[model samples]
Target: MGFNPKDAIESVKDIATNAVERSADIVESAGYIIKGDVSDGVVGIVSSSMDIATHSVEKIKEIATGRDEDVDEIGG
Candidate 1:
């Protein structure tokens, strides 16, 4: 058996996706508690979470493929 980069990348992607979803759920709950509505929270959470997840996957792919030049560019 040998280490697989593809599997590692996929695992990271899954982690990131799950984190985004969990964060969204937390935001929705908090919004309902504070504003008595989940619409605003849902809208914002969906938009921002998708962007975050997409960017995370893109960065992970770039890093994995050796396409990422400036590591500092991450999270900036």
Candidate 2:
């Protein structure tokens, strides 16, 4: 089959998502190790922030690549 641009874009998205998730995990782990009990609140905030950042990145990528689909959903 010929190269499909959509599939390539999806693959790139998957890679970026994995990288962001891994970074979040590392940050959470470090927070826990450093803050002990207080890390719970900090981790929650960090996780949500990461989710928003990921969603924003995806929207930017979609716009940059000229994908016209509406991105009304956040952290899907």
TM-score of each: 0.44, 0.39
Cα displacement (angstroms), candidate 1, residue 47, comes to 1.4
lDDT of 2 by residue, 1-76 (tens): 3345776577567757776776776677667667765667566657767775776676555645445344453335
Measured by lDDT, the strongest candidate is: 1
In model 2, pairs of residues that clash are: none
Q: Could you give candidate 1's per-residue lDDT for residues 1-76 as a string of tens digits?
A: 2345776676677667777766767676567647866676666667667766766766666555455445556557
Best by the TM-score measure: 1
Give the 10-residue window scoring lowest on summed lDDT in candidate 1.
62-71
* Segments in model 2 whose C-alpha atoms lie over 4 Å from true places: 1-37, 68-76
Error of 2 at 24 (Å): 19
